[model samples]
Target: MDEKTGEVLGRVVVTQRVGWCADLVSTMARSLISEHWNTSDVGMLASGEDAEGRALPSNAWMALRRLGWGASAPEGVKVNDRIVRMAQEQAGRTLRSAQWRAELTTGVLTSWPADPAKRTADEWVNVRAAVPGGQHLPSSVIKSRTQQIASFARANGRVPADPFELEGAPGVARMLLLSACDGQQATIECREDDPSRVVLRLQLPVRPDPR
Candidate 1:
């Protein structure tokens, strides 16, 4: 049974009276990602574990639903399956992207420098080896990470145990990950009036007032 919507994932199929809208899709994706990121839910999702330490499903959306972090459509705006699917696709992509940073933070924590200001050649190699894909990463990236960790240590008087403890959660950009979404969420087609022109349409979530 699906915990979020209280519906069976495979058995029940409800038809939508209206088609999905690109604007609405964009709105929902933005809202879901923003909500997750702001609440540190993104970090939890990236960790692939709940407070109980149980392993979560590899799929981001499923993990979210399992954690009861599932999102909903905008109030007064009805959404269809395709719309929800698209939002899920965008959220999944964002969550997956965070895994890299999580691994990087863990690597840095495991290979903490004797001196953040100066990492010896051997220290450099150790840190690189500890991190996944660290060999290809630029020196600036690791240096920046070390600086962050150093700052945390200075303020707290103790090194953070992990990414969650170090940064709580990573922030995500507020844009639709259109490339990550399925064709049902967005599409591109040539304009009939002008062959040179093309139309790229996708959905977006609504944002509350800045105030």
Candidate 2:
């Protein structure tokens, strides 16, 4: 059984009616270690009587402890159904290009523009006036801002240039522009018949689990 995924990777069934010995043998077999000891040797070991009617070897006691006091041992080690489905569901989210970019853009939609060149000082002031908590122009700027914006649009399901222009509306432009500003590969093109209209194209990665 896979502890993380809760998938039953294997199973073991014992028909014996013996008590502690049966449980111990089943557990050891499930753990893939039964072949190491002979059946007669195990019975003698479990008898609990040593030379002069004293206790058995200390090694046997230690082995029992290592097996987790019988019941506490790993569940799959004996039954193979130990891991529940819920355990697998708790693993970290899968790293997906589209999902990752979409999350980033969603965050960007809530943030103010951080670039000075792409956003004029007056524009920044106007935005701040409209959205009181909006962020102002960043002190340092990058020359690849346009490229980054294009890439983000492509990765997040949109055309780069148009995504920037689409958010040009009063207080939302900064957020949209910032979303397009990082970690993606994108391309921008203007309509042949209408130079005023721009098209942003993006490329998204395929998801492994279509469901």
Maximum-lDDT candidate? 1
Candidate 1 matches the true fold with a TM-score of 0.58
Full-model lDDT for every candidate? 0.67, 0.32
lDDT of 1 by residue, 1-211 (tens): 3334465434222111112244455566667766665326666776778889999887655676678765577777665555566566667667667667878988988988888999999999999999999899999999998999999999999987667577653443434445545666568889999999997654332232110
The residue-by-residue lDDT of candidate 2 on 152-191, one tens digit each, is 6567775433222323211111011112222342356799
What is the clash count for each candidate, in the order shown? Answer: 11, 6
Top-TM-score structure, candidate number: 1
TM-score of each: 0.58, 0.18
For model 2, the superposed segments whose C-alpha errors exceed 4 Å read 1-104, 107-117, 122-148, 152-211
- Per the 3 Å backbone cut-off, how many clashing residue pairs does candidate 1 have? 11
Error of 1 at 209 (Å): 13
